[model samples]
Target: MTDPARSTVDLFAPDVAAEPYPVYRELRDAGPVVYLEKLGAYALTRYVDVRSALRDWETFGSAEGTAFNPAMNQNVQGVILTAEPPEHGALRSALLERLRLSSVRELAAWIQESADAMVVPLVDKGEFDVVTELARPFPAKIVGELIGLPPELTERFVLGSDAVFAAMGPMNARTEQALGVIADVLTTIGGITAADLAPGSMGEALYRAAERGEIPPEHVVKLLWNYAGPAFDTTIHAISNLIWALARDPAQFDVLREDPDLVPNAVDEGLRYEPTIQIWGRFCRTDVSFDGVVLPGGSRVAVLFGAANRDERHYPEPDRFDVGRNARDHLAFGYGMHRCTGASLAHLEIASVVRALTTRVRGLELGETRRHLNHTVRGFERLEVRLS
Candidate 1:
């Protein structure tokens, strides 16, 4: 078979990370599987190929760890993100006790109330920075309360979550710095005991699960890390990006306002249009062929979630931001068993923000924005807006 297409795409470059859709389009156009020369990894840019790889986790194993760098891969071992088979299921089961759809649905009323409490005042203010005022604090509050994290420690965890994703990239200066932050965050988490957590909180529940032998006591901290690290960054970015999308397209916000029932669809479309997670790593366990292109054993494969979500072949008029579009199939939360355990919670949080905005704000006026560049995630660090 002909050699797989190769591209010199520097996905981690500041410029590329700032505005990656054009590069995503280029990667998708390259082929089903393109070799990324700079990273020494193969990229699955097409929706079909990406979905297939994510689904067939046995071939594209997570056991070796999902991050590109060896240190991160080793660091993430045994967590749900890296575990395979029976161990993965057991770990996931414990997590789902609180994160399942029914459980998440039960929290909707409180989530909506929290969103209103945070957003209504911001709306009344007329102008605010979406990142600091709404997006960041909203999730930080919700997740913090749920996890029983002390209010003072919330910001550190949020910063640590960013570091977690940042460290997943190549061992560059950024990754090195992120590693230091992660080490500090881990140390902080290690200090917490069952007594330190709030009664009936998710963090406390994890400790209880360990006590009951549902999961090992040793797994409690790593499981807590799983909950804390992922719960903020992706949802925070999603909320900000969704609002940014609506701000950029008033017509879409209008569409959402006309049909409040479309809030879930709006969230999905927003995730598809600009996935917070741009890429994730998978190690090829053995020689695997995708559309006649062979990925040799022991290869590092980059699963381009952002690219697949925007693949024109999978999403018609992929670039357009339509709140009514049914894009829930998007890879933003990934696919298959390894899909994000907190997806239900994320949807609830994002939908809560949408409901609050559509109810209270007539329109949104976009202002200056800045991108939050990280190795694997894409989002705005500062997003200013005026609500009318």
Candidate 2:
């Protein structure tokens, strides 16, 4: 039996954040559930436990707040990310009606064309920071255009979106700064009207839904606030992570070159291999037991997505960066009801970039990389690369 006394680990510690995989392996070996006194939550590490917890929203809830700290958990309410059931359904449907796979598929050609155009200039440049030049800017631009915002506003939109992801952690300096950014974003979103967006854009669609009483008028602002993070940050980091993976393993890039059909698989593997978001918070609404570990009602829990993705129980050779692996079931975008609403759109964007990169560049040479530090998400701040 594992020692229950040694279950706790400070997840927010810098060392763990910098390289979480090693710690994840240790946690998984410890047991399915580890009681983390530091964060006042039970940390679920094993793939089955984490996946089950996510789907059992009734037992492990998000309604109270999905952040580690009470302040954020409480303040983050009313947003789709924190809401439950009928409320969540309303908030999500408002946006998904337009962001659905069929609807987003219409943008596939544009996104591919855009990806090709963004990559063409860099192909000849030989060396470039993928984070700044391609991965970072492209998603923000695409999200802005989709939301009907002017291109100039994309930067601010991205900053605000970053804050959304950062605010998911415990109350700390990062959360403090993120609160300020979120406030500003809300103010900007509150002022926007359907007319401000393109004639038939997602932003316009949201407003039109509000007008039709499909969702609350107040929810229009919430919907706008919601799109910034999922639509921009996660997809941005996924693309960067994919590029890093291919560059780190040229054989994988060669695999892509040989069979462009694997671009979708490549995206899935990237998300599974190096998910952008590391951990997410959920609260127990009732006493829940998993693998003999009983979490009392009202207890907070951390779902370690990064760890679950690499769980040996679910994936053999999980650490290997193999694009051919069937990683479609990974928890990177989450699972069940709260699964990312923009999963299809994010996939489209990532696939477009992969397809374009494989067709254009022969290979990539890694340079110095600077990783971004956020309380919740994992990604690059600077990823230097040289194309051959």
Candidate 3:
């Protein structure tokens, strides 16, 4: 297909955020790359192109910032989210050291225990808002324990995280407001010490890295910010989306209930079907030709995970919410060097919840659902359901 010269899309528009699948289809049909004029960024809609750009971090760099807004993108430099390699390698290593598969596996019992504790009480309630009751509260608590932050402070962390995700999108009332809140969260984080977190928690590990000079002391607080936004927000939304999916299709829940081994697949499928972070940005480091189009140096490119995950070329019946779908290759946790550091932990958390639901609840009756209008994160803010 010939690349369309003009595909102006206000990605942050309420209508688009409310229902983006249609726009995703339009962009994919347009060509390999669609120029979003209002946001001044090229959007990659096809699965192949999106995956290619994510893996090719050298040409499509992160150092210039991944935020859609030029200012936010520039401002986010130096942090793990924006730093390119050698630097990214060092920073990523420090994080992965603590979050490696073996390390995260040790927490499986803790995660299952947490899920059981929260879900057991609610199973008999017959009706509850999954978002606020389970999805929202559960992740905040788990992240709090993982990061060793006080339970009271974890509540504030959720609000701060919402803002951090918002700041990644185009500059507007929402992004501006979130920037202000993030400033305060940063200040609060700057004051944290090892004593502030749980013993042997990720937060303490970060401090140990700083003390050993593996990471600069100044970046310690910034690293804590990572646990707040990306770790908490994405998993919470993924869990919410998963429950909603199962509830919508009771037979799917039965599929898992009959074979609990499918819990992990359910998590992967949920992420693919409705990714939490719908889109992420990358900066072009130098002139690069891709899919018959040259992306000039310094141009911004938006990688639409939502669109890519739904690409029919990659996934058959892309819109179907099937628990058995092997979606491990999905870009929901991203790809390449910058793939999500806490992916193992997220999988454990989501799977634990899925296991608890399938094993405990006889049926899930979904009620009114309300989606949050996040320009970047696509998920529900409210999902009412009853367990019987």
The local distance difference test score of each candidate is 0.90, 0.86, 0.85
lDDT of 3 by residue, 1-388 (tens): 2443557778788888888898998888877777888888888888998888888888888887888886677657767888776778877887787788999998899889999999987887878999898998888888888889998778778888888789899888888888888888777887788888888888988898889987789888878886666777888899998998898899999999999998899899999999999989888778666667766677888899999999998899999999988988988999988899999989999999889888888879988999887768878889999787
Could you give the C-alpha RMSD of every candidate to the true structure, in order shown? 1.0, 1.7, 1.6
lDDT of 1 by residue, 13-43 (tens): 9988888889989888877778999999999
lDDT of 2: 0.86
Best by lDDT: 1
Screening candidate 3 with a backbone cut-off below 3 angstroms (N, C-alpha, C), the clashing residue pairs are: none
Stretches of candidate 1 above 4 Å error?
none
Instruction: State which candidate has the highest TM-score.
Output: 1
Clashes of each: 0, 0, 0
Give the residue spans of candidate 3 off by over 4 A. Answer: 1-4, 212-214
- Which 10-residue window of candidate 3 scores lowest in summed lDDT? 1-10
